[model samples]
Target chain A: MNKRELFAQIQEKKSFLCVGLDPVMENIPKHLLKYEDPILEFNKQLIDATKDLCVAYKPNTAFYESMGWKGWRTLTETWKYIPENIFTIADAKRGDIGNTSAMYAETFFNREKSEMGFDAVTVAPYMGEDSVGPFLNYKDKWVILLALTSNSGHKDFQVLETGGQKLYETVINTSSGWATADQLMYVVGATRAEEFKQVRKLAPDHFLLVPGVGAQGGSLADVCEYGLNDSCGLLVNSSRGIIYAGKGEDFAERAREEALKLQQEMEQILLSAELI
Target chain B: MNKRELFAQIQEKKSFLCVGLDPVMENIPKHLLKYEDPILEFNKQLIDATKDLCVAYKPNTAFYESMGWKGWRTLTETWKYIPENIFTIADAKRGDIGNTSAMYAETFFNREKSEMGFDAVTVAPYMGEDSVGPFLNYKDKWVILLALTSNSGHKDFQVLETGGQKLYETVINTSSGWATADQLMYVVGATRAEEFKQVRKLAPDHFLLVPGVGAQGGSLADVCEYGLNDSCGLLVNSSRGIIYAGKGEDFAERAREEALKLQQEMEQILLSAELI
Candidate 1:
């Protein structure tokens, strides 16, 4: 989806929330196991319950890949189930050499070939421009490059000073020149709320797919305080906090309740900021 | 395989050559299309012909993932076809959060789960220690971390000065503390021959998986000059230069011929160093 359309959806839904579909069999409701594919069924109901509450769905590929071929099937089916208007992101964190990266782009962006056409795919920036170039080839699709991650390990290399700027800052500055805000986004973790202000200065207009909220203990108000832009260019993601809210037969409904809380908070924030 | 076993295999084969099985369907011989799975057949033949010459086989995951579920199947079958004595690397270059990275380790290391157990899986080090710790949980399995890549884009962030050391150097120094050399390795590209000496200073004992030889214009002699240690700690990979050496029915034979040339050169280097 284009930036304008995404912002429109956020305003219409009164939320810029992006639900994370990182399902683990052990975490889903017990009653759903009777289905042929419990994960797929769980995802379908979750989407059914919370489709109107969020503007995007991000699926981390590791959760699916760990289950082998069956897991891949589940991922493909889940992609098919999500509503098209909601932006879909393959949070795979994939990057390689130029030619090899082209294949990865085809895997996620070529719907006819892979049967899973995500509107965007998260990419690791370790391999540099060529590794990220292929994903940008799909004109309308987005490449959410890893900048400052939420994990504790983010301190290992991301914060190191490089050429007077921190490593993540160099990543933002160098990568910003590679593509326009419409085609490129950055994965800036919500854990570092203070860094969001610094990041906004570097990438004032680009959308930041903010993870590490809810289950990871990142505050939504602090994130929005510094993260919001004129276009509402922030996709705050909540995975386990929303999806695994309840383990009963009404798990989907319970998930909607959790999503509603976030949506309501986000609506108030948007109103106060006069973004909607 | 453990470090000792890998070195023994190198001595047994009299070569440290690693044949990269990065096959592209469009590049394979036309006659192979008659098979039920041309890519699998091509890989089997390539392994059959070059198995004796090279001590390791690294099938880059991108080449297969681009094909979707069918491609993943081909990768599993191809992994099953390789000789057990020879080292196998799923050159996946994957890493994420601690819990998420564990799934990736299982995806490549746990044969019971993923149906493909490789000796080593290349990992990107951007996420820090937690991202790499899970991969080290499996006994005897290796995590070949990306230290310094060969691509032109390597200069983007890898070589930037950070805390008086380059980003790649910091990665090697910090990661070396996480795991012993016996279980850890680094990807030191052959293209940067001058950097090998510096890399050796930081990681003298850790094995370096060197890519970018023939097709990428890296000289084998230059890489071995400062790269070889007492254990001959290097796995020089040549993909397109060897796999697509010829496009006819004799493709396997031509591939073997190319592999043999590198193996012969490697054998001479090993003999001259008196490490065999």
Candidate 2:
């Protein structure tokens, strides 16, 4: 899905929240495990409960990956459960040399021929041009490259200066030449709200996948104030804070409630900023 | 799969080579496609042919992830096929916030209860302390964090100055506090041969997962000159150059030949350095 359609979905649903599907077998309700595929069962219910209230559904690949074959089957099935209107992200932090990345592009973007049919993916640009360029080769698929992350180690390297600019800023500027704003996006962690102002200046039109909001103590107001673009171009993800809101049978219900709260606030922010 | 055992395997094999399992469907021999799982079949043959030649097997997770459910299945099955003595790596570059990263730690390192049993994993430390610390929490499992990448873009930020120190240096120095040399490793690209000398000073005893050896034109002699340590802690990876060596019915055999060439070179390096 393109940025315009993603924005429209947010406005129509009155939400900019992207609920993260970082499922843990232990954390999942015990009753749900009775199903043939417990993870898929849990994800289907989560999507059904919060689909209307959110603009995106991000399934972190590592969670499914930990489960091996069963986990992967559940991940694919869960991808089918989400509505077409809602943007789907294969939170697979994949980045490699160009020739290899081309196949990764074909794997996720080309559904009819390939297995992973996600609309977008999270990429690590540590490998440079060839690694990231292959993901951008897809026509409509989005490349959410890592910029300034939301973790404490982000201070280790991302903030370092390169030719008078921070490493993250340099990545933004250098990679901007490879793909346009339409196909490219940056993962600017919500916890680093202050850096978003500088990030916005580098790629003004590109979207930003903001994580670490509800659970990580990154204020929604702080992120919106500094990161939101001319379009409602921020996909704020909240995994533990929303999905595990309640561990009982009412888990999905409580998740929807938390997602609803975020969406309602996002609607106001969009309106106040004259983005919608 | 602790450091001591992994080192023993390298000594017994008389080889420090880590065969890269990056199976691309299009590149595989057509005869294998008739099987239920072509990738798995190709990998089984490749593993069978080279099991005695190499001490470790590193599977780039992106290749399996692109294949979806089947790809993930192939990866798990392939892991099972490898001999117990050989070190296994799930080359999934993962890093996120603290709480979320804790889940990643559980995903990769918790094998007693988890389906994906890997000896080590490649992690991105751009998120700082919290992101990297969780991965280090798992005892006996190695965390191969990104330090200096080999791609063309490595110049963009990895070598940048932060507070008068190179970004990679800062990562190597600071990350020492998170994990011991036994559990922590850094990805020092083979292309950055000269930089390996400096990297050794910061991380004298830690292993280095070196990529870009063959197809990327990184010299083996150059890498060994500056990168080797007392334990021969170097997992040199060659993806396309080995797996897609010939792309014909003899692909597996060709992969063995490519791997043998590297194993021979590593043997010489180890002998000269008196590591074995």
* Best prediction by lDDT: 1
lDDT of 1 by residue, B47-137 (tens): 9999999999999988887888788888999999999999999999899989899989988998898888999999999989999999999
TM-score of chain B of each: 0.99, 0.96
Task: Place model 1 in a CAPRI quality band.
Answer: medium
lDDT of each model, Cα atoms only? 0.93, 0.83
lDDT of 1 at B141: 96
Local distance difference test, candidate 1: 0.93
List, residue by residue over A1-276, the lDDT tens digit for candidate 2.
877787778778877889999888889999998988888888889999998888889998768766666777877788888888889888877776566677678667777645557889888767778778877777788999999887776776777777688888988998998898888888998888888889989988888999889777799999989888878778899998999999999999999899888888888998899876
The sequence of per-residue lDDT tens digits that candidate 2 reaches over residues B1-276 is 888887888888878788889887877899988999999999999889888988788998768767767776777788888888888887777877676677677666666545666788888767778877777767688889888988876775667777778878888898898889899999988988988999999998999999889888899899989888888888888877888887788887898899889889888889999987
- Quote model 2's TM-score: 0.93
lDDT of 1 by residue, A126-217 (tens): 99999999988887899999999999999999998887888899999999999999999999999999999999999999999999999888
